[model samples]
Target chain A: MMKTVKIKKYSGELQDFDMNKLINSLRRSQADENLVQHVARNIVDQVEEGMTTKKIYQMAFNMLKSRSRISASKYNLKKSLMELGSTGFPFEKLVGKLMEFEGFNTQVGVIVQGDCVSHEIDVIAEKENNHYMIECKYHNSQGRFCNVKTPLYVQSRFVDVKQRWKSQVGHDTKLHRGGLYTNTRFTTDAIQYGTCVDLMLVSWDYPPQNSLKARIDKAGLYPLTALATLTKTEKRQLLDKGIVLCKEVYENPILLEQLGINESRQRKILDDSLKLCSAINTLI
Target chain B: MMKTVKIKKYSGELQDFDMNKLINSLRRSQADENLVQHVARNIVDQVEEGMTTKKIYQMAFNMLKSRSRISASKYNLKKSLMELGSTGFPFEKLVGKLMEFEGFNTQVGVIVQGDCVSHEIDVIAEKENNHYMIECKYHNSQGRFCNVKTPLYVQSRFVDVKQRWKSQVGHDTKLHRGGLYTNTRFTTDAIQYGTCVDLMLVSWDYPPQNSLKARIDKAGLYPLTALATLTKTEKRQLLDKGIVLCKEVYENPILLEQLGINESRQRKILDDSLKLCSAINTLI
Candidate 1:
């Protein structure tokens, strides 16, 4: 069936289902051409009026899962990121790691002196003549967009911190920028305010070219939680131990042994992580 | 037995027991002088190291509850204000009523045009030549202080709103200001930023001169949720109907009848409300 169907988004917004979007995501999972077509067709056939995008995603994920565990894990990246933590500290660490992978000296949580007061900045990244103070807004709950108030307060803090940074020696020539990164979406007003104030706004799908999802996919920085072989408990344990990247598991197979997994299971898990991260950039 | 005890506050901070503060609270409950002295003596005698201020308040409340429901209800004012709903609309309305009692023309939940965008102002009070844009931060959980981020964002919103307000005709000679009211305490940082930006901040125990608790008691504008006679459901029903003040019950006993409360009980409840609000200002 080639019929157009309305799909409800996490934000309760309704929009006509785009077949190309689903196909593109499935292809991004590294699924073969035949399997992608099969999954896309299955989703299109099962999709009905007022079905939530969540349900549609689940259907596609299940189809992909029955075929390839590696592809399924890749497809499950968003939900895996959501499992990071309620407080978003793990997510902050993930972001800091991403920046580190890109040759930036990054601090996950550091207390920075502002002009008026001190601020506990989530991530501070410094690279060649460029310094970024990033605030990571993580919501475990779906559809909780970072609103205008976030950027409003963040902008003020940025101004205060930037003022203090400017007063330091050797900072005069350095480019200091403020960034807001959230796992979920940013409201239009948040985007507007953040943009108006020249704050780098990055969310799941915002800013089109270099969104959080795009950056993660490009970097092959899938979180350890995204591994389908790992249980929730195992995922949480890995997260607790600061093993955020699937690439970390592949690099250190002994970490699985530390988790009390059998030698055979450790090999399987490590193999899966390696195959998933085979396309990862050579920086790490 | 009159030894000083290091009691823990709701914010997890340690503080020494002050008999005079407890005694003063009892006196404000409108309990007789003898009862206030007796309660103070009992609290002082029972005060133990590491006991929470919450526990101390509960002990005093139970002692007052047995002697006088009116006094207990009055003493329960802070907790009652907290029960004004989780979303805090009722608290906003109660604030609007308090402002109304003070003869200021007030609008709660007003949408005002800002310089760049629009803002949903919590409370806007105007009188004579003064206009105030107020934001109310209500927290159901105890010890959640309004942090510096509050004033930081509020100041930005206020600046945006004030700029738009100034553009209107006949506003040139009038004074525009910003106010922030919270049911909880404000962090020292919040107070500092607010003060620096000239934002009038009123919290439960802040300012010492004109705090939220003081204003509510002084105006005799106790929330209807403070009535010990009303059940949770009944209070919610009254709150839903926009009947926030205890004085509203005294002025109109029929509201109880609307809640399916019988005649005799309604009379008793009204009498209790009257006794609680008997010290109300003549202006109210």
Candidate 2:
């Protein structure tokens, strides 16, 4: 029988460490079973009571990084999303691209006229006469939840913009919806308010069946920041170039060539991105 | 004839220097005419193209400080408001006190139940069967305007809370109004939207005859941070103690005594506050 170890979560809550959950997460990275088992055994020996989950995650990530870069990258999805930048431009662009892949015609960072004023909607998506004015609330740090004030404000903005949209030509019968997307979690009041207001609330692991993370995994649209083969500087350069998804590198090998990387290194980078885009159960 | 020097504003707009405007501002500080003329002459001689209005104000303020501490404190009203702290707690307290002085029964930082959820209203005031829910938007930096989004969201929160208030006992016929007060300025669009929505808007200098600055002058409720005699640390200590107004210090000198300042320095501080409270046209 193994002793239970209580680990501290980011929200400062304590929970018993589940060895099976750790093993399942490592296995989802598509790492070799032997390597996953070895890492799990090492972590079990080193685990202590009251250790932060973030510290535990770092230990596993470093172990995986030393063995295989692609698996490590796949294991680092949440942190990768956070590194997209604090200004939220890259995150907005990523959200716009994700919506486009979901078969919606999307516009990123457009200024729309409202009933009383104009609003800079983060992403606007339209499909089958259904229009969504989405706002992306990105936080650089953890433990910061989108509070009820967020939905309260976003709902008002959507109402203002919808008022203008309904009065436009040939748009009277279309369904208009407001969406609030964030890389972080939302407070209980925020969720309740958003649900009550009919806001399409999406966070990192919310909504059970279809969250931001689930949507990304389902679409196989891993962000470029997740690639372990790319250095932080290189990832920033790619983001600056408006290339967000791993599929962008897998399809266009010319991007690596333009970055002046050696042929062998480019091949390794391309292989990792290709495997990442095709892998099932990429998110833990 | 003096050469026309272009002065840069905080908004990055360029305008010709008006020496008379500067002179009149100094005069409003209630400084001696000779001191005002001396500062104006020195500023004019040193004025050059593309110097910021901030720099000009700093020069005049330094000159006034060397002569009259009371006048210098009054001249520094805008900057003093900014020093009230970034969290906006002190600003809310000051607003509540100011409203109380205007014959309203005021509550600061209260949580009120809304129609959907609860809201943290900054200040709730009632006078003559009229109820008001006020939200204070405080910015620590210059040039940060309260945009249309601020009023848009404030209006929503007001509507939600107002709905709940209407159902309460004996409150059916009372006039409920929403107010947005800011320490800084507002964009034209913000003013337009707020007025259109019937939200009472007050910023530093908006609604010319009845702005925040105007109310502060009329009520003689200068913040303790406006005193030149106190150090920044001392002002912070007083704010943390919930003693926001200079009138509080003027009426009760023991607050300064408790800060462990000697009698001479306390006398100096009290004298300055008394003069500041009695001065007419303290703002320009």
Candidate 3:
């Protein structure tokens, strides 16, 4: 006998369940075809009439977690990045650290004098002979997407900064390289405009192999928000005290004291960080 | 000797001398012709190079404070009202109390259902055969004025509420009267539109006789911000605790203990409240 099914949305509104949404989310994690189908079917069969979307996510996440840790991390990546916005300063700092790991000397939250106006650059990175003026867009909500207007606005700002630097300090100062980085995905229009304007666009999944997710995974520079051992408040406290990278806690166990995590949880976090970092090292 | 003159603006920008501005401001306070001239001339003469507008105001205020207490209060009225915005809740409470003293049974911060939408009415009052909805516009800055757009927005909201009440409960519901009450002066356009629309406009000096200032003066219901005895934080604390009216504090001497004011200061505050209230009583 068929049963009537309803799922509670994030907004607490109950609606008819859609199987395709779960399937797409699972496929995005690069789960195996059979496992994805099996997980989706299992969730549908187990889901009650009034189960919340959060509980549904948990059921699927737990199933994915057992199969593949990396896939589970990728599935939970968006939420982890969203948690970084407890304070904007920490997110900028994390972005700077990520750029640093990519072999660029970076400065976070710097006020640079442009010819016409002063611009606050989120991240300024310098490689061998190139300079990048990065604008880091952070969103606290999962539903917020970086759209075309953002790139357009940032490109104009970048032009002003580039012109100012060229006029004031001579043409040798290369401030033309501009990038818009966001923890969320960019809209199709944003990608098109950014590519046309030669503005570097870095988001969660764009550029496939060199996207923000790939870079973080390759560098083993997971943000503190990625650690499931820490509570939301604990992660916020850690971020507040300027601890953004899980590697920081791994290198110096003393930082975990700030989180007030019990001895066992602290060990688990450190062990997880070390194992994750080593696993990335093996891939390289 | 001609002194190098400069006046620092509220935005902290220093500009060259302008004499007419000061003269016009003094005249608007309804000061006597000679007093206005004398005060303006004296301030300009005593003003040193690079002196702020605040210092100039203090010089004129000191002069007026000694000559006429009413004039001084009138001159300082805008600033006093601005302090009411330390928190919006207290200002709404104060407006409700003012309405209560005017023989209307008042409610503060009530959510009323409209036909198309729900509105959080700032002050709702009911009398013998009339019901009034008041929207309290509170501004924390001296330069901010209630403009035409405010009344236009409020008028639309009033229509929704009126329509909803009419449709739901017939014509005898008595939700016709709507008033826009603000602690600051209204723009000329706002006054014109509100007058044309028959929306009661109660501001600092509009309508001449029954203005907000006049009503507060007649009722002797000065807000806690009007008390010169309390510090900024102390006033905020009193406002937060729902002790909005000086009359409330005057009747309850125990409230002073929460402020941590010394015996002498507490006595002074109570005395000032009693004197101010009695002064209004004498006016009638």
Candidate 4:
């Protein structure tokens, strides 16, 4: 579903840059050199919905690009969730990581029907005839083991519902089998419940190359535009080695050699990345 | 739609109690008090999903209701939202309030045609035969509304792709209508775009109820079980006198009198609600 946005953004550019952008351009086209920048800031400040970069320029009264300051559009927006602390908790991102590494066959958010909600899981990986329900839970800490009972309660009931519903003569029955995946360990009672319900609790203890460490790095670099932000030399190196994120780029030196960056620029990217790492690290 | 949840809770009694009361009965029946309490806690924690009191007991120990805990099932659920903080930032309850407010209608998340994201508009209003998109930017001080440009920049754009489809004629064309709403004021350019495109922008002022208070309060109550928490004393006033909310109940005491709240209780209700000058005050 997220892919739909990218597809539409491309088509939108072909349609005359959208009316919202056109208006901003018109404003920028009219303003004078010094005033255009001043006006552009003010106009951007006054900007509201249905506004495009075109409308911003038009608002500044500069039809000529040279006449206006800050006349260009912001080409890319890499929402560094690390930099923007308020974005969101990384649970879903972690879920994506877990699924990608384990090769969960289904897309995220697809509800799997099973004997119980615990037996019911987030992503389903079915091949040939055998499949398992994975109940995934993400907890911030072990202290919240008490809270584990609630999710189990839900999963059990959901499994019951699925079983009852499937026993109905006309319903499909294979969908009623899956296991559980949780970030935290279950209590004695929870473990009992999982077993009774035939729920296999998969604890995420950072699975190896298939490990969480590598996947987190890979998921963070899913966007192409963000990779473009690296230095030009770094960019070519990453491209040559197909190293997009700090994780891969750091792990692979061949790519760096291919790009042939000077020691100072390499040091600069590291410094810049360190600052970013500090910011991002604080997010969760 | 939210109203449906409340009305749905009107079963298994409170015995006249409610779903909550019904579950409490199950808790009481357990031979082991500690286990019963732990089970009760699970019910309480997982209540957002509308787990019945019976199910809560079942989760603790299957078919335990044959014991004394049977009575716990009678707690009058009253309303689902009531169990999960009468007014909380949680999504389901927020959805209930948003859907119930006047001029706002939540479509089932689907390929519903609209010019914005599904949950983007905080509140919506109708004006001049168009649905005005609203983004209620709540703050400590009515959010110094110096500009709407950046705010408006975020308004969703719907790209018409029906004609591009192979089954172009088969695709639904009933999407060109519908406006967006926001809690912030629209800029001149935004308003111009709105007028040009038949979209309307409604700004919510800090004294939120200042402008839309009456509309929201009078919008009518949703039937979600969440409403049951108001106590019988509360429900009567809303239904009997057409008082939709506690604010409306306090604002117009004749309804409270009709609900049989003594003048003293009526005053107390009023005192508890004076700060909630608008439905948004209470709704948020």
Candidate 5:
């Protein structure tokens, strides 16, 4: 008989342990300083509406295995996007806000479509006559805005998306207006393009005139949040007032408000709650 | 017509974009992190070994997701693991080493049962009147020894293990001889039991005549490992070489003979890899 060697592989605690107990153990051990645990926490926080605990845990797993190679084929090291703090758990909210600003502020109401394709526009929203496609970039920290793709790529993605939309949505305007939002300022070209299209950019939480981002950071998300006309301090307050209050406050009768929450203040509150609810659901 | 209300919730990123593209973007962002890239790189590493690239990526995906809890879980508003400079990858390999030791040391050529249940045993050879079951515990650090429950669990796991001399095996005292080895002295129970049952609690990789439970920290793994080992620089050198090389050098008697290395040196090397590997893998 041909001789053969056997390979034995040791299984970590998972060999026979319950996953729920394992999660608890992980939550406790998260205090340990390591990349594994940090990513684990991000995955946990991203848990949101309709997500299973199993899927929540799986997010951490998926992130760990993903290879972001600026070109892994060459460098043998996948590029990393962690220069920023945990991308806020409610990533989708940022995209929604940008879409709304692009579509509603203009003549038409925009319908959000497709998830963020990065510079390609996180989502393409449709308005009455024009398509106000938007590219929303979310940053967990102001300094960390250095973490996003180059402005060149952002412009390229937008061009590709715009051209593609012309084929599909027939929004081939000789000139089209689309908004861009990034926590960080745009690369030279992106800024110029915004100027070209009459597209406004909410590059930072702090408006250019007031520098609200710095104040918010110093005062904290709670204090400045209350200062916002639409946003309130209490999560429950937002929940109670609900989107109905938002419509009453923001959506004008002239605009033919279909949304219950039209008021900017009430809408912001509902938006915040919806975001929180999503996070809770995802993590649970 | 009845009145209809379309409410926009203040939620996170969900309504922001097309869900499909969102997944793609997440995947792309994931490739940038080391935790994600390493496994992804390694998964493709075996592509040359006849593993499909897709399978490699998928396996990489599965493996990465498994470590999700280890990646992003943070504490003290800082990274728990990344700051320590320890990636869980090393510990994962440590698990493989622990599982492989016995199979490599099996007296009667190691046989792998590739069935539903898989594991290996050392020294399948029967000893005259007594049938000895050798369970080697190559603890590189801790002085703790397995109690009766250890053998009880292991023996139970041998649901249908075949015995060479089925009747003779029954007659002789079925010695659940545990080969206890560590960098420190065995616990009092382990030492006391050493005299009665077949126990070899030899503290090898520790300081000269140091007590078993000396406070030792996994310094090299200092960031990746949390094992406390003896201050013996020589033993630490073996550990520094990594568990796999240490095992090859330490566990192989022929290699030791050919290398002109003394048995004690080989033994220490083996002890370092065994215990270190076990403790480290457990952390993952």
Candidate 6:
């Protein structure tokens, strides 16, 4: 057997190259198992010792792009989310709109009272008599899970509000609900505890067919980050104006001009958004 | 008007008696405004120039107890909660059990993860598909309200958890909700913010009929603090063993034996619990 090649991680640590990790990541894009394995082998043969994980990812991404654009886009979803912003405000806006699409009256940021204290809730939604307080978890990096403690903490806050309601109001009124919404996945323990406690958990690709990704796809509400033609600044400008979904830009078209993109680029961006919307529609 | 008398507060400061504050408090118990006014005038006439507010409260409580037990119980609710413990752990336990009665599966004193840090959730509850995380803001004094900053901090933790989930799990799981529960009340700002964000707020008599006091009374799950027959240490012992409700002691009379009370007092305690339970049953 040939000697295993050493690779460098983003953290500056060196370790033996792991083929399984790459294969698993590729599989996440829904690439065929045979294609993934072949790509992994080809990338491994071409890899220099001490290559960074980022470099390896780029190489695989490029190779995958040649095979399937849809798979490449799927693979790049996490990276695209990171590009939403450092503060994650853009992600929060996206979540708020998603809730609105789901038919809940949504507010982005507001303060709510508890029995003993006041809290600034990130998002609050109401449907008929039921009220929902949501915490939008946005991440700038991939591979991080909402850990168990988050649910614990969130559950604690909900308990406070519920208790407050019990003390101040008579029992006939409905109890307000609390939920944690994230753009990624939760840890096993988080999922277990969250499920056990009935905390509504929505993470990417979690719960199989009804994840944030699935919901966005179903609603055809892809964020501007999905567009390859748009630059980071253009996406930020659009997001800043509360324009999150690509379909919004696709319909308005004029909004693209506000981003100060050249005529050609604006046309390209709009064209790209149309294609993405259609792609999502076809998938649905 | 007859010469108004100055009274001392628990803080050792002296001030003139305020009839409006007294009337408002009595009104909260659903006392007849005329009766409250008449009672206030009578008490004012009897008050010495340098009597304490505690004395004034006691006089009003005694008079109210004779007039209406429901109002008396409502008035005493805050004081009884304060007596749960100086440390507030006992009260937290009571709140936990109360949540159980309201159809939530409850856990007390758990550590949960947020995106940036881990938090010790005071209470976490689940019902159906909703999880409620609570921060039990138990107070030894009755006047304090949960302030704006507490909710701000709680909301921050929620935001952290949401962000972590986004990073770790590609979006599909629901976000765990948050609440703040206090034995006393929340400030106006807290209420405004909480309502705005849909933070489930439950304070003493906040939402009229469906308050924490109402829930406990409806469930007949009064804490040991509400019992005059038990000493502080005895209450603590029962609380430590997770026996928070007086109804629990009434059903399992042997639990009271653990407190080392003599047979005669045990009979009295049992009788008092029976009376209290019947009173609660009547209210429901």
lDDT of each: 0.87, 0.89, 0.76, 0.38, 0.35, 0.74
Q: Which docking band does candidate 1 fall into?
A: acceptable
iRMSD for every model: 1.4, 1.3, 16.2, 20.6, 29.3, 7.9
Candidate 6 runs further than 4 Å off: A1-24, A27-42, A64-71, A101-103, A127-130, A142-145, A163-176, A184-189, A217-220, A278-280, B1-284
Could you give candidate 1's per-residue lDDT for residues A1-284 as a string of tens digits?
A: 58887899978999999999999989878788999999998988889999999999999999998999888988888898889877788899889987887899999899988877788999999999999999999988787889999988887778778998999999989999999999999998888778877898999988798888778877777888888888899988888888888889899888888989988888778888887676465324
Q: What is the TM-score of each candidate against the true structure?
A: 0.84, 0.88, 0.49, 0.24, 0.25, 0.47
User: The CA-based lDDT of model 4 is what?
Assistant: 0.38
Q: Give the alpha carbon lDDT tens digit for every residue of B1-284 in model 4.
A: 11112212324433222345544454333235565555555545454444454454444444332332221222211222233322222222233354445444543222322311122334333333333333333221222342423222223222211122223453343333334333335555445444443443344322345322223233423222223224654663354433344445555767657667686666655653442333233445
Candidate 2 collision pairs: none
The model with the greatest TM-score is 2
Per-residue accuracy of model 3 over B56-120 as CA lDDT, tens digit each: 88888788767654455546656777777655777788789888888999999999875444678
- Chain A TM-scores, all candidates? 0.91, 0.91, 0.81, 0.35, 0.35, 0.77
Candidate 4 chain A least-lDDT 10 residues: A1-10
Model 4 spans > 4 angstroms off: A1-89, A92-96, A99-106, A111-121, A146-148, A157-177, A204-284, B1-284
DockQ of each: 0.46, 0.57, 0.02, 0.01, 0.01, 0.03
Greater TM-score among 1 and 3 belongs to 1
User: Which sequence of candidate numbers ranks them by TM-score, best first?
Assistant: 2, 1, 3, 6, 5, 4
Worst 10 contiguous positions by lDDT, candidate 1 chain B: B275-284
Model 5 residue A221 CA deviation (Å) reads 18
Error of 3 at B49 (Å): 28
A1-284 in candidate 2: lDDT tens per residue?
A: 56599999988999999899899888756689999999999899888999999999999999999999878987888899988876888889889888997899999999999987788999999999999999999998887789887888898889889999999998899999999999999999999888977999999988878998777777778898999888888888888888888889899889988999899989889988987787654443
User: What tens-digit string does per-residue lDDT give for candidate 1 at B1-284?
Assistant: 57878999987999888888888888878789999999999889888999999999999999998888888998998899889887889889888887887899999998988877778999999999999999999998786889999988998788878888898998978899998999989999899778866899999988998899878878888888888888999999998888888889899888898889988889878988887676564325
Using lDDT as the measure, the top candidate is 2
Candidates sorted on DockQ, descending: 2, 1, 6, 3, 4, 5
- Candidate 4 vs. truth: CA RMSD? 28.0
Q: Which digits, one per residue and each the tens of the lDDT, describe model 2 over residues B67-92? A: 99987887788899999987999899
Positional deviation of residue B272's Cα in model 6 after best superposition, in angstroms: 57
